[model samples]
Target: MDIKEYIVIAIAINAGKTILGIYNSDVDLKLDQSPLTLADRKSHYIIKNKISQTKLPILSKEGRKVSYQHRRIWSKYWLVDPLDGTKEFIKKNGEFTVNIALIENSKPVMGVVYSPVLDILYVGAEELSAFRIKQASELLKYLTLINDWRNYAESLPLLSTINIFRIVVSRSHLTKETLEFINSIRDQHSEIELISKGSSLKLCLIAEGYADIYPRFAPTMEWDTATGHAIINATEGKVCQADENNKESLLNPKFIAGAFNVDEKRINNHGR
Candidate 1:
């Protein structure tokens, strides 16, 4: 990990601590019909404050919205979702995560997704390989061994075998389109198994090879998938949009992710 990656990880760990604090308390409702908590607000403040040291503009869910008119002028920026999966958080399912990514030229160059409940941190950067730090070690301990953290971490694509078509979908939320997409693939894979997970972990599962694909047919903001995209792309997996012709859009549509050679035929065929 470099200096930027180190800072992002530290911030995520700190933010995760804040989120856990709020998780133990009552949550409130947002105007957008989603759950909100002090953790969300506090995490946003903490990340924004820390990332400001890099002197990069941030496009966070809780911060001022930056339209493409202005956002396009920047060569780089910070994309963050202080706390993802508020619904899961409200349900206390321990599937929520805090996501942070460094975006350069519309692509996530560095990513970190931290789950406070699970005490798992997944990180990936441009020159650095993706790695996961689990409950066995303290996250900040890497601060002292930034260049050698890989020595204490587990590399990505955790599995080398692709046994069957395994899929990851939202446990608390699913869409008709997603179901249809799954059925479309069932023709090619009879032993397809479906796993339910919340937050950006779905993408992380695909990155580490615990699952093969996560198709998102419902709506999702840029921040929701940016970090996941980075981690997935760091390995052999990827997150893509519906428009095959336009690859620059950060907003997600119906998309599919899998290994490098995983047939994207289904997504291209089902493009809406």
Candidate 2:
């Protein structure tokens, strides 16, 4: 791994420390009726401190949202959601994650998703394919020997054991539109499996071939799915905005990740 990648992993691991600490604490409410603990704030601070050194403007869920006029002028920027699946964290389900993505021309060019409770990390870039470390040892082993972590990552779309038309969906925020999509698919395919997953890890699971697709009909911000979009796109997959035909805007939009052929296209990483 390059020094920049190593630094990002280190920052994510340090932020995980804060996340786990807050997970064990009493949970409460944040904005939009969501939960926020010290983890969110600490992770945001740690990631911003390290990533800011790259001199790219960062857009994070915790930080103030930048005006479109200001952000559109940039050719590149950092996108992050310091703590994803806070509800799962509050539930102590060990499904929350840290997400970071690099946006070039409003498209995710690189991404990293770390699950502290699972001790796993998923990374992908324009220059490299997507990969997942089954167990990252809380990033300790990576800190000790970066080469080992880099060498051990399993490539995306791991061989599937079953020939099932699997569909992975959000565990907490399932919508009627999503259900309708699933029902429609079941008519064409005989063997259908619905997998429940939380956080951006839902996208990683699809990249790993655990699920065939992730069709999210509910709303999502760019930060929430940019890293996942990058990782999946690296695997020759697509994460598109289903609402607009042009799909040029990167604001909130409906997202569906898989090998779907759609008129509106937002090509990411150009198949790597």
Candidate 3:
């Protein structure tokens, strides 16, 4: 689908999230420990229904689980986390997001993440590249008249070698493994800075060039990182495998990183 179509779908799904989040806040907002919520369920339904029009198979957090016996046969599918960051949503911090990613051969090739509360959308595809689009403030006047407003793309700025390295981490799910990884890097890179954020926005920061790296050591399903990973890859970054022996070392073709102009040897050495 084209970017315009994806934007419309994203906006519609985000509207559902906003409505449910507002309506459910007064009801005690029970947490399932797993972070399930009415907003998550509702948003999942809305997004699933819309994407169902294409008759594509989907592996969603809220949807029925097809056995791996059957799913392993498919070459392409949609991986979705209808509502990411249930903790932030319940806290009313507006850091949650809606994620949809197209996975092919165990890798996400396209992704769209929409934050309704913030009115920000991040879309990426292998061929089209990745971009962040936001609505114009003045366009709010035509909200009723115009179904979709024009969006301005946010581009990544150039980085200076001496600039501080900003690392993005999860606010609610920090783990010992993650800490060790951070410590290992900090020992070598003294200027490293940490920015804790909720949900898939961690990857968005890297895509937008706001952060240099994001190390996720805790358990996360494929859907959780697929969308953001695709966007990061589009921006000349990659998500490679973390070294089994050293948490700080990134394993090639597994760990993800954005595109860098440096030689492969330097990139591999830097991660180690």
Q: Give TM-scores for every candidate, taking all chains together and pairing residue i with residue i.
A: 0.88, 0.86, 0.78
List model 2 lDDT by residue over 60-162, tens digit each: 8899456767766778888889999988876678899999888887678889999988878888887778888866654464356666666777887677667
lDDT of each: 0.78, 0.75, 0.65
In candidate 2, position 87 carries an lDDT of: 82
What value of lDDT does candidate 1 attain over all alpha carbons?
Answer: 0.78
Per-residue CA lDDT of model 1 for 5-103, tens digit only, reads 877888898898888876766544333323355678899999999989999998888874666677777778888999999888866788999999888
Error of 2 at 234 (Å): 1.2
| Best candidate, TM-score | 1
Clash count list over all predictions:
0, 0, 16
Error of 1 at 221 (Å): 0.6
The alpha-carbon root-mean-square deviation between model 3 and the true structure, to one decimal in Å, is 5.6
**Model 3: number of backbone collisions:** 16
Better of 1 and 3 by lDDT: 1
